[model samples]
Target: MKLIKYCLILALFSPLAARAQQPAAPAAQAPIVLRPGDMQVQARSAANRPDRAPVYPGGEQALGLFFLEHIKYPEAARVKQLSGMVVVTATVNVDGSVSNPQVTQSLSPECDAEARRVVSLLTGWQPAMRRSRPLAVLIQLPVPFGTAGHMTVDQARRQPQR
Candidate 1:
């Protein structure tokens, strides 16, 4: 008799419990469009120039400060006094994530690794916009040394990777 009563109670609440457990609707995915010369331009810059360049979350000044705070001159480099620019090539994705960091220019192996490490820490950029749509762009960043030598992200963004 008690089992029958419990079964009746469970049955009454099961629909409500099931409804609560249902997953929310997924977001719609955007369609990708490709035109001729797309890869060539993106291979060069945006696939083409952007309507608006990607902004580091706060701004360029903030980015400089980020580099200053995050980048560490490697101990070996410091000991050897090997100071020069470390050019890191990275993509600021449409999702505002930094990806594919590469050391296009090397100062020292230690410095290159350190520069890559620092660049990888950066995220949450205002993605590049083209025709009012978000797009990814390849960017070169120069992290300099000796305290007064580093270029700002704006300067770095405009620079071509070598």
Candidate 2:
């Protein structure tokens, strides 16, 4: 009877003992930060070539038309025609998704807002890739707003010291 009781007790505690014997999972690891020098070294080691042309979603003219048609031009701004370029920095993900679209340079607030709006609305493009993987590319778009011969900010600023 004692042997049977001991067996039952052992059976009951066997699972618990087994669980306890197993090693505990290691603690979560912290992310690593790469310094500028490390990044430079990594870049140098990477097999990136300048000769290859970057892939864009569509032709420049088509893209420009898309921007022109879709973008909301600022109507409130006194000057309608904003005549410079918008430098957009976009991160093209592996899945061909455009993330972190930002305006690096702008000529005017109206132009900037329009460019930002267009860029934000842009969907996943066929990202330029090296070795069949997507890569981030900087796209500079020269957006010329055709308005009645309006004075530019620079022109206004440089108005013969009136």
Candidate 3:
């Protein structure tokens, strides 16, 4: 009877002891491979004469002014007399189409959204060129917004000190 009891106890604890002694499994390794050649890398350039001219060279300035006149601050945004500057970076394709419009700086979420919306509506730009052929080129535009009394730094500087 004693021998049988001892054997039963040993069997019950043996599995638990074995589990505690086992080493953890090693983590799986990710596969690695070399990439093939022939991948083309695209380079972005600014719009310049002889290569390409701004579709709306002076028009970008006009668009900035248009926003100042048109966009009204949203009440829900708690932005009273909202004012900030927007820097739009875009690639003008060879065919004079604007692509990859990016906002480099943002003053407020609403202002940022509005800037993007306005830029998207712009069309009929002169495409940039590489070697006299139309190619994608990057351009940047800075836009300012504000209400009366909230002047831009430049505007403030130009004002006579009181």
Candidate 4:
């Protein structure tokens, strides 16, 4: 009976002991394969010109002023002293209209909603241009909400990333 017990204990622990004694296998390295034309540079064409980004109707200052006028501080944020920038991402359509505004960085629910509302209300955006053709683009607008004072676009831009 004692021999049987010892055999059972050995059987249970022998595999673990063997695994612990073995060194870890080295990682296999993948071979680098290169095909023809991999390093060849293509000639630049007029159609390959860099895309022009979308512009606001009144530019940055005017857009900032519009936000100052329209964005109302949320009572919840004010009560909680929640002061931070909410990053709102949206698509500027080929027609220069804003669409699909969403909160990418949220400070609070109330502040997020307010930021989305102000962004959606924006208009007169100049669509991006590629080779003189209008193109839609994604844009990130930072909206700041604070209880201390009204936040400006410059101030919002200066906020440290969380």
- lDDT (Cα atoms) of all candidates against the true structure: 0.83, 0.62, 0.65, 0.83
The pairs that clash in candidate 3 are 55-125, 55-126, 96-127
Error of 1 at 89 (Å): 0.9
In the range 111-138, model 4's lDDT, one tens digit per residue, is 9999999999988898888878888788
> For residues 45-117, what per-residue lDDT tens digits would candidate 3 score against the true structure?
3335444456674575566566666566556444465555777887766666667778998777777776676
Alpha-carbon lDDT of model 4: 0.83
Sliding window of 10 residues with minimal summed lDDT for model 2: 143-152
- Candidate number with the higher lDDT (2 or 3): 3
Better of 1 and 2 by lDDT: 1
TM-score of 4: 0.61
Error of 1 at 90 (Å): 0.4
Give candidate 3 regions above 4 Å deviation.
Answer: 1-50, 57-61, 65-72, 76-78, 147-162
| lDDT (Cα) of model 2 | 0.62
lDDT of 2 by residue, 32-86 (tens): 7888766433344455532223444676656666766886656744454445566
User: Order of all candidates by TM-score, from best down to worst?
Assistant: 4, 1, 3, 2
